[model samples]
Target: MEFNPGPPLLQSAPRRSFLKFTGLGLAGVALASAGCHIQKETPSGRLDIGEHDLAVLNYAYALEQLEGAFYEKVVAGFYGGASALEKDLLTDIRNDEIAHREWFSDVLVLKKVPRLQFDFSSINFTDRKSVLTTARTFEDLGVSAYNGAGQLLALSPFLNHAGKIVSVEARHAATIRNLLNFGSFADSDVIDANGLDGARTPAQVMALADKYFVTKISVADLPTH
Candidate 1:
């Protein structure tokens, strides 16, 4: 996969609506869906993130960058049999992810966060199954990534901000799942026995996300306090 430097593609939607949607948050929901649980890690050379809030924010920015890039490529050459609706839907999602990416970048400005390089050569945009499956992986991971980062958030406001983003991510996951196979959204595959969706840890998310990135993710000064 080639690493390209530039802004996120396909963000022409009205920014007001997107911002309003984000501000709305996930109010009045029976089951608040989160990310995959971060399990204990074995021997792996993955990067270790610090306990600092900025580290957590950096983690989020990295994933958003990946997801935004993935959708951009998909919309650029939508899979075979993709309809107008699919194109528009994915484009809107692309815009949202890019919005999320930019939001994190703004937050991390003082920290001097580096733009990440991504790998999408494995995804076959010409095939619907490949594209949808990859979307599912990303959406799931994104939700779980937020969840994993949840406990590390030291401030309520930052936690609230993360909640808004992850809830939207869960919505994106459900949309992709339903598209893959109607009614597959929130099935036994993702939701737990208690009906609440799961969340993952930073290490776990990084492990799962290793395949999508060409640049080795290096985390420095992770907050441990």
Candidate 2:
């Protein structure tokens, strides 16, 4: 089957969806009155995740968890029967994803974001097309996530780190797309009409991610602007 980079299976959520989904109208109003203060409990049991940092970390952590689980399945299945080149590329991508997953895991462990649980019900591990298509979606989303979250990082180091990851993720996206076709790598669909890639805020990314993740992630504290 030819791989189709269809319109996002899920639509991005606007501000109204956040308020409705999280029931944060009253809390949002309250936070605004208090100079926009929102407190988040971190995984270490001793840290607090304030508005900006916590939200970005949570977003990255969520993506890492998803990618980690996905690559683990891909590598395991390929161990049984996969072509040489496919094996090589998938292995490389899996390693990269593991590195990303570990980076987020360590950061969350330090800040105390609880370990994440994943559900891959939507994926068919036995089918190469399905697996590659899903990988394409995730890699594309990762690039977009970093692009969208770049402005949200208040620290220079974090911003630079995000830039580093985004470049790598864009590479991953292009590779996976090309693997699905001979010349579809980094096509305009992924890049967009402006000659730039797409971006989505935490709320937007989380909304789409929620479909694949069974665990409910609360983004009530994320900022809209």
Candidate 3:
């Protein structure tokens, strides 16, 4: 809206080129500054994800589904006074999340994996603090989730798929972070001592995601061990 995005955001990192970007740390931690609620849970929502490829695939799928729905709602009722740039940025991210969701869904379909159901009542679209803060959380979560799921991929080819998508997620993370604070494209919270982006296990991720889901996800059988 009326708030400036601060300095123009640096362009998002290119494919597999995140390492080349020095200050690209995770500064979205500030998202936690805001608070928000849950609407309802869908009794039938289930992940049914198993070991290796299936686990990694569904993990990404679920996260994409969550993010896509999040952005969709954000656009539908954009914060009270959104600016043109703000609207465009959120819409672009929405498109990216939707594309990511479709890519995983297409792949999962071949394996006969069922679609996912998400509930966003937990988010309060009317509040800018709640909105941006939540956006920051999802973008950061998406990037880290991909990083964690990378090494667990079963087949070599799927790594290519993950790689392609993670860079995009990283871009989304950077943009969202910048929107919160001009120079926050990258911050120490998400980067490790080795200057690498941090990773999270399936258990760790599902625990946090369960809060917003209408259905509690079951990743209990995942070989994330």
Most lDDT-accurate candidate: 1
For candidate 2, write residues 145-216 as lDDT tens digits: 888888876655456556767787888888889888978987887787778999987778877787776555
Taking the tens digit of each residue's C-alpha lDDT, what string does model 1 give over 92-206?
Answer: 8898898788766654443524666787888788999999999999999898888777877775656777887888888889989989999998988788999988887766777
**In angstroms, how far off is 206's CA in candidate 1?**
0.9
Ranking by TM-score: 1, 3, 2
Q: In model 2, what are the clashing residue pairs, if there are any?
A: 42-112, 43-112, 43-113, 44-112
RMSD (Å) per prediction: 10.0, 13.0, 12.1
List pairs with backbone clashes in candidate 3. Answer: 24-186, 25-186, 25-187, 26-187, 37-122, 41-214, 42-214
TM-score of 3: 0.76
| Alpha-carbon lDDT of model 2 | 0.67
lDDT agreement with native, every candidate: 0.70, 0.67, 0.67
Candidate 3 lDDT score at position 45 = 50
Residue 144 accuracy (lDDT) in model 1: 80
lDDT of 3 by residue, 1-225 (tens): 111111334234332232123221111111112121112222455545544566567667878888988889999988888879889999988988887777565555434235556777777898776888899888778778878778877555567657877888788778888888888888899877787887887778877778887645566655653
